[model samples]
Target: MAELTTSWLGMRLESPLVVAASPLSHDAEAIGAAVAAGAGAVVLYSLFEEDLTEELAAPRPSGAGLDPYLRQIEMLRQQVAVPVVASLNGTTPGGWTKYARSLEAAGASALELNLYEVAASPEHSGAELEFRQVDVVSAVVSAVEVPVTVKISPFYSSVPAFVRRLEEVGARGVTVFNRFYQPDISLDTLQVDRRVAPSTPAELPLRLHALALLSPFAKLSLGCSGGVHSGRDAAKAILCGAHVVQLASVLLERGPGYVGVMREELSGWLDSKKMVSCEGVRGKLGFGFTADAHAWERLNYTRTLHAGLPPGGGRPAGG
Candidate 1:
């Protein structure tokens, strides 16, 4: 059998399939099921700063506030042998250090700082926003002993430079992209409906492009998220140099046991390829490793557009 073991955020994972921060890991039973189903690691649902602030503003409820999140972390650590990564979703540097320290004390194996922020303020430049994010990461890193990884948004003007800044500030890893929830307009009511949409396999190419671009130069461990559904999808992530692949929608849609199915299929593919481990295929198709490094850039875009046109170099018959 091919070795499936890989490392992420300075911790050794038994497999590349990690459960992303989601409601599926809200309880010990669910976490146990995920571990039983072959998840290498589990990232608990995020503790949002806004939620924490709101809870704090309310009158005391006998230690029921942040205790739930902390309790979940402790319970998950006790329930599964794999690493239990605690996720903190916040934009600022102020209050995060406290919770990060608490999570470390709760026995979290590592921490994923989910920097899911939108720069809606005209006062802040892109550079200012990026620096603020880096400061937040630095504060959390200073507060926690456990490894810290940042789950970054894809809207950054320069991903590579930002990733380098993150690494310099002591982030052990960076998850490629964070899914931003967009609101839809209800045509009849003329109101905005905030709904969370599940990711599809089609989303993989975006993550693949980011991974391929950063894997060569990034010193931090690279993880791919957003549209990981099957064994093939996970394999593609590894090939593009992702140290690990995070899954949420698939597990929630198919149940935890599907992770085992993905594991088996991935192993089968690796065995057939005569590869010893995931590392063997890691970065095999990344920017620096590819014959045409420019393929991931604008050249590939132009080629794709030209290739799609008819032989006569005009639009198709439907046009």
Candidate 2:
């Protein structure tokens, strides 16, 4: 009943509930289910650029490539009235542009570049790696007429600078921090293993950090998406300056119908707050709004060592 409709990356979304790039959105059936469940738009499973290269031939099952995904994407656009976004994660700039066009032809309303790379090479400096990231985003933006968004990892040293670079390269928006797998040890076999799952709710500080950095830049629309659980969580993201909030973990827990429940909860909260739209509350609680905002400075951690009730409260690390 409230004015929940909004524009994201220049596309009109009836609501702000976007189904994040996940297995659930890989097929027409799931996409339709998401629409029925009240998703504003569906971001197709991230198609890997490596899936198109020789690297894919190296034994392991490759990320399902675009070939098998076209039919699903087409059907989703036809069967659902909401925008259907195409997501791509590629290594080369060439494939990014080519695939962006192919996805557009397949009926995607917009594009999300999950621009990923792990620069483990000692030969390349961090500076070079950052430049390559900018080049990749620029190439994709130049190749696509559809509104473009990029999903970023939290591993960068200068997140704000990285986001500003994406904006300069013509990205319409940025999603704060994609949850990549971290490798841990398998004690039994003494092997490395990656835990593949959504982030826990405790992992919210990173999003808040991103929100603080990107919210002030009017040209950048931020999507704070790391550990959102409920309507209050969603509301908090928007309040801290995210333009949209993407969900993966909560939906995985409660199923697609959770979308409607969260939407309803968000609407009710807005009504209670005497707000008609998300835009009105957006960024109202950001650092700029607080008087003693400087406490957010990371250096405060080292300086604020108060003696506490706990035994080792004021002691040094590992004391």
Candidate 3:
């Protein structure tokens, strides 16, 4: 039997499949079911900074505003033996330290900071934006004792450098690519409307590329999120050097019990390959392990384009 145990953010997990931050975790029963179904850990739905500010500004009864969110984390901690990771989504640097401390007090094993900021302003330079992000991470890390990880965006000018800065500020892990929902314009109202869409398998390659590129230089734990719907997808992520695979859409679509199915499939693949554990196969096909380091750059790009072309360089039979 292949061992599926893996470590992320200094916590040991029974498997690589993590319950990503989502509404499914809002219920205690659902959390227990996911753990029973083989989820290694559960990341509670995010507490947005905007929501926090609004609540705090109104000055409700003591602990009235934040009590519900904090109570959910406490309930999850008591219901399952696996680690419970708390998520905080914010764009600015202020007001996170206090929340981080509260989460740690609520028995959260780790914290995931979802820096879902869109650089829309003309005055904010990339360097200024990057510095603000790092400052927020540093403040939160200093405020909490538990392991801290950041859910990063793929829009960074230099991902590797930013990852290094995260490590410098004491982040223990980095989850690749937070999905930014693009808004659509409504023709009738002539106003922008929010649109939400689930990830498809096609998004896996982008996560894989980011993981492979950073695995060689980053010492922090790497998590692959987005488009992981099956064991095969998780396997590919592991091969690309992801310490854990985060799932949200698949669980919402198939229910929590599907985690067990994915676990069985992943275990079977490992057994057939004679791999002892997930750690053994991690980074096996990453940039550092591959024979052609530049294969991920443009080598495969040119090869794939030419592979479909004819000898005469004209249209093929289908065309």
List the candidates' TM-scores in order.
0.93, 0.87, 0.91
Order the candidates by TM-score, highest first.
1, 3, 2
Best by TM-score: 1
Candidate 1 vs candidate 3: which has greater lDDT?
Answer: 3
Q: Which ten residues in a row have the lowest lDDT in candidate 2?
A: 300-309
Quality of model 1 by C-alpha lDDT: 0.88
Clashing pairs in 1: none
What's the true lDDT of residue 136 in model 1? 92
Pick by lDDT: 2 or 3, better one: 3
lDDT of 1 by residue, 100-138 (tens): 888899899999999987889999899998998999999
Cα lDDT tens digits for candidate 3, 1-319: 8899999998899999999998888878877888999999999888877777887678656433467889988888888999999998865556688788888898899999999878999999999989999999999999889999999999998898999999999999999978888888999999998867778878899999899898987899999999999998999999999999999999988999899999999999999999999999998878885656665578878888868866766644565
Candidate 2 C-alpha error for residue 294, in Å? 6.7
TM for candidate 3 is 0.91
Model 2 / residue 300 / CA error / Å: 5.9
Error of 1 at 304 (Å): 1.1
